[model samples]
Target: MEFQELINSPGLWLASSVMVIAVVIQAFVFLRAALAEARKVGMSRERYIGGLRSAVITAIGPSFSPVIVLLSLIAVIGAPTAWMRLNDIGAARTELAMVSLSSALVHGEVGTASFGVEAFTYALWGMALNNMGWILVSLFCVHRMSKIVERLYAKYNPAWIRLLMSGTIIGLFAYLLSGQITSPMLHGQYGKLCAGFVSAVTMLIITRLLAKYQRMQELALGLAMLAGMLTAQATFG
Candidate 1:
């Protein structure tokens, strides 16, 4: 059968559905464990429920972008592969990049006639293999990470450790943002810059204004993202 035919087969659909069901079960298990721990730690049930509701609300806004990307992937690949990859890794951009690289290696590109069965198969293998390293490393390192943290705390003041953590987070975000802001490809596209700036400003304003409101503070990030998207559309679209 052709790659497209194979990807959309009933067998593939069943496999993908099983994987998704497993993820759902894992999520429920973790949630149940966390709630039990929270109760043991004397957290109020109402407060715990409120936090979960706020998290759901916040997640809904950011999830739309990934859903849009998933739709695009479904057109390029097929429903089964798209659903499995998206659900398993939850990183559309990384998955798309790996698929593109695989296609290029096979002398084809996605969404074109040259992307045949061989290219599709190559892309599938690439996606599956590329993410394995991170998973393996995390599986091994997660337990050891606590030891590393303890060493750091023992060697440094608690305040210094906090500062280091905050600085690392800020530096990482700045690095990512700088690439977009300074990219030669985006030199002429001021809309993206404007949107980023607007988003940052919106976040700061919301944080300051909603400092006393716990629920509103939780929504700040989502609202800022929405504002940025709207500003970009108005300016560029």
Candidate 2:
């Protein structure tokens, strides 16, 4: 069968949906268990609810970029593959890179007339194999990581530990931002720099102006990201 004919086949959709459903079920189960534990620990209901609200709010901004990437993937791959991968361990950038590499290895390229069933199949396998290492490491090392953190807490001041963690997060973000801001390929593109600067300023403004508003505090990240996106569109789109 032609690759195009198979891209959105019912069989593929069924297989992918099953995995996505399993992930969603697991998430709900974990959430329920967390809420139960929170109640058992004498945590205040309002505080627990507020934490949940904050999590949802903060997740919105980070999720938007991934969703945009997923939409693009749907056009290149298919609905089933894109949905399943993004729903599972697939990161948009990583998945795209893997797919392109797989295609190249097979002497083809995605969206080109030469790319066919064989290339697509190889890309799927590449995505699956590449992600397995990270998944396995996480499964094996998560508990060990928790133990290390516990030991750190026992040995050091909690405030200092928190500062260290915050610094680590800031450093990681700075590293990512620096690549985009300084890349030779992006030297003439002001969109990325403009977006980053707008987002940072918006976040600072929201943090300072909405300091006393708990509900607004939860929404600060999303609002900042929206401001960044709008600025990028106005400047470059």
Which candidate should be chosen as best, given lDDT against the real structure? 2
**Which ranges of candidate 1 are over 4 A from the true structure?**
103-108, 184-186
lDDT by residue for model 1 over 88-115, one digit each (tens)? 8638988899889998998979889888
Clashing pairs in 2: none
Report the lDDT of model 2 for residue 168. 95
Return the TM-score for candidate 2, rounded to 2 decimals: 0.85
Residue-wise C-alpha lDDT for candidate 2, range 106-201, written one tens digit per residue = 887877876788788888888989889888999999999999988998999999998988999999998998987777345687887888889999
Residue pairs of candidate 1 with colliding backbone atoms: none
Q: Name the lDDT value of residue 121 in candidate 1.
A: 83
TM-score of each: 0.85, 0.85
Cα deviation at 108, candidate 2, in Å, is: 3.0
